[model samples]
Structures are given as C-alpha cells and as structure tokens.
Target: MIRAITGLLSGIVFGFGLALSGMMNPARVRGFLDLFGQWDPTLAFVMGGAILAMALAWLFQAQTDKPACASQYHLPDTKHIDGRLIGGAALFGIGWGLGGLCPGPGIASLATQFVPALIFVASMLLGMTFFRLWNRG
Candidate 1:
C-alpha cells in the first residue's frame, strides 16, 4: 500500500512537472528535438536538471544505511548491446522525432484534447504488445 501510494504521488508529481515544463506540448518537444536543424536546445536544460537530480539521489543513497525503499537496488547486468538494442533505439528515435512524444510526457499529455496524443498512446501500447508477441514467438 505504501509503495502504491508513493508511486501514485510520484507519477502525479512527474505529470505535473511535464505540464509545467511545456513538455506536454508536442511542438515544444519537437523544437527541442530539432537541435541539429534549427538548433533549439531547451531540452538540454531539462536533461541536465535530471542528471543533477539523479546525482543528488545517488549521493543520498550512498550516505544512507540502505536504499530509500524497503527493497534492495537491482541494476541491470546485461552487457551486450547487440542488434536488438540498436534496432529498438533506432525505432524509438524515429518514433519520437515523427510523433514528437516519448512515453512519460506522451501519456501525461493524454489529459489534453489532442488527437495525435491519443493516437500516440494507442500506437505505443500496440507496439509494446507487438514486441511482447514477437519475443514470445
């Protein structure tokens, strides 16, 4: 129950931040992504802030007796960055550039009356389902 409540609160806060940051606006995100072309680099500040936040979290965790949660931290050990990872990243890049939406802000933007956002969410779920099926086969 505690974890669920915490997760809900965290998601709300994240969504609020997205809305506040203009990340929910596809145009803003597309502009941010188009640094190579028009050279809009507003997203860099957002990313830098996130990196700083993660660093602070890591510093806190290192000082603490244990992880902030009741569970142990589980980091991935998969060292191989093979074809699958590359292919997936390329697909994600294309989707993000074309659709102007990544998962978090994409889902958070569903509250707004944007047909493209809705379509993005639906297609994202479909893609996830397709990958699950493809991997299971």
Candidate 2:
C-alpha cells in the first residue's frame, strides 16, 4: 500500500514538473533538439536541474541502507552495454526526434495535448507490445 501510494505521488509530482517546465510541449522539445536551426536552451536547464536533483537523491540513497517504503532498494545491476541497449537507444532517439516527446513528457501531455499525445502514446504502446510479442521465445 505504501509502495503504491509512493509511486502514485511520485508520478503526480513528475507529471506536474513536466507540465511546469514546458516539457509537455512538443514544439519546445523539438526546438531544443534543433541544433542547426532555432535551438532552444530551456530544456538544457531543465535537464541540468534534473541531474542536480538526482545527484542529491544519490547522495541521500547512499546514506540509507534501505528504502523508506521497502525492505530493500531495487537498483539496476547491469553495467554491460550490448546491442539491445544501443538499438533501443537509437530507436528512442529517432522517435523523440520525430515526435518531439519521450515517454514521461508524452504521458504528461495527455492531459493538455490530448490528441497528439494520445497518438504518440498509442504508437508507443503498440511498439512495446510488438517488441514483447516478437521477443517472447
């Protein structure tokens, strides 16, 4: 129950931050990605802020033996980079470049930019489903 509540609250805060930072805006993201053209530096500040926050979070996590809501902290164990990682990253970059929205901002934009967000999210889900099915061997 506590874990679920924490997850929900974290998601809400994240969505709110995305909306507040103009990350929910596809044009803004695309503008930020546009290097040769009219590039926007707003998302750079947002990224920097996020990195700083996560750095603080890491510091806090280092001090804790376990999570407040759980008995243990769940962390990624993988350090090896393989084809899957590279392929997924390339695909994600392509999708983000073309659509101007990644998963977080894409999900957040569902409230404000419903139609486009819906399309993006639906496509993302479909892609995910296809990947799962294809890899289910």
Candidate 3:
C-alpha cells in the first residue's frame, strides 16, 4: 500500500512538474532541440533542475540504509554500454526529434493534447512491443 501510494504521489508530482515546465508542449521541446535555429533554452533549465533534484536525492540516498517505503534500493546493475544501448538511444533521439514528445511528457500531455498524446503513447507502446518480440530468445 505504501509503495503504491508513493508511486502515485511521485507520478502526480512529476506530471505536474512537466506540465508546469512547459514540457507538455511539443513546440517547446522542438524549439529547445533547434540549436542552430530559433533555439529555446527552457528545456535545458528544466533538465538542469531535474538533475539537481536527483543529485540531492542521491545524497539523501547515500545517508540512508534503505528506502523509506521499500526494503532496499533497486538500482540499475548495467554499467557497460553496448550496441543495444547505442541503438536504443539513437531511436529515442529520432523519436523525440520527430515527435517532440518522450514517454513522460507524452503521457502527461494527454489531458491537454489528447489526440496527439494518444498517438504518441500508442506508437511508443507499439515500439516497446516490437522490441520485446524481437528480443524474445
């Protein structure tokens, strides 16, 4: 119950932050990507703020034995990057540039831009499904 509630609350806060930061707008993200053109630095500021928050979280985590709502920290074990990582990153960048929406903002923008958000989410899910099927060994 605690874990579920924590997840819900965290998601709410994250979604609210995304909406507040103008990240829900595709134009804002695309503008940020336009470095040589009419570039916008708003996304950079938002990303910087997020990174700072995570850094503080990491500092707090280091002082704690375990998570407040969980038994232990579930950290990623993968340290070495391979072809899969590079390919996935390239695909993600392509999708982000073409659609101007990644998973978080794509989902968060559903309330504002229902159709576009739905399309993006559907396509994302489809891609995930394809990847899963392709890697099923």
Candidate 4:
C-alpha cells in the first residue's frame, strides 16, 4: 500500500511538472526538436533539471541499502548495447519526431482530452502490446 501510494504521488508530481513545463503540448515538443528552424531550448532546461535531480537522488540512494518504501532497489541490470535496445530507441525517436509526444508527456496530455494525444497514447499502447506478444512468441 505504501509503495502504491508513493508511486501515485510521484506520478502526480511528475505529471504536474510536465504540464507546468509546457511539455504536455505537442507543439512545444516539436519546437524543441526543430533544430534547423525555430528551435525552442526550454525543454533542454527541463531535461537538465531532471538530470540534476536524478543525480542527487542517486547520490542519496548510494548511501542506502534499500529504498525506504520498497524491499529492494529494482535497477536495470543490462549494460551492453544490443539490437533490442537500438531498435527500441529508433522506434521511440521516430514516434517522437512524428507525433512530438513520448510516453510520459503523452499520458499527461490525456488530461486535456485532446484527440491527437488520445490517438498517440492509443498507438503507444498498441505498440507495447505488440512488443509483448512478439517477445512471448
């Protein structure tokens, strides 16, 4: 129960931050991605802030054996670059370039009931479903 509560609270804070940072807007995301044209650097600052916060959190986490709200720290074990990683990253970049919305911001934008966001989120779900099925086969 505590884990779930903390997860929910963290998600709420993250979504609020995304909304406040204008990342929930597809246009703003596309603008950030636009390099040769009118590129917006606001998202870079947001990303920088997030990186700094995560670095600080990691520094704190290094001092602990386990998380306060969990039995153990669940971290990624893979360290090698492989085909699956490259393919997934390529897919993510393509989707982001096409729709200007990644998973986090895409879900956050759902609060607005925007049709494009809805379509993007639905497509993302479908892609995840297909990946799971393919992996299980």
User: Which one is best on TM-score?
Assistant: 3
- Give RMSD (Å) of candidate 3 vs. truth: 0.9
Candidate 1, 51-118: lDDT as tens digits: 99999988987787766556776657888999999999999988888877899988998888467778
TM-scores for all candidates?
A: 0.87, 0.95, 0.96, 0.94
lDDT of 3: 0.94
Tens-place lDDT per residue, model 3, 43-126, is 999989989999999999999999999889999897999998999899899889889999999999898899999999999999
Q: Candidate 1: minimum summed lDDT over ten consecutive residues — where?
A: 66-75
lDDT of 4 by residue, 1-137 (tens): 99899999999999999999998887887898899999999889999999999999999899999999988999988799999899989989888877889999999888885787899889999989999999996
Q: Give candidate 2 misplaced runs (Cα > 4 Å).
A: none
Model 2 residue pairs with clashes: none
Task: Report the C-alpha lDDT of model 2 over 27-137, residue by residue, as the tens digit.
Answer: 888999889999999999999999999999999999999989989999999889999999999999899988989999998888998999999999999999999999998
The C-alpha RMSD of each candidate to the native structure, in angstroms, is 1.9, 1.1, 0.9, 1.2
Q: Decide which is better by TM-score, 1 or 4.
A: 4
lDDT, residue 51, candidate 3: 95
The local distance difference test score of model 1 is 0.83
Candidate 3 has a TM-score of: 0.96
Global fold similarity of model 4 (TM-score): 0.94
lDDT of model 1, residue 16: 92
* Pairs clashing within candidate 4: none
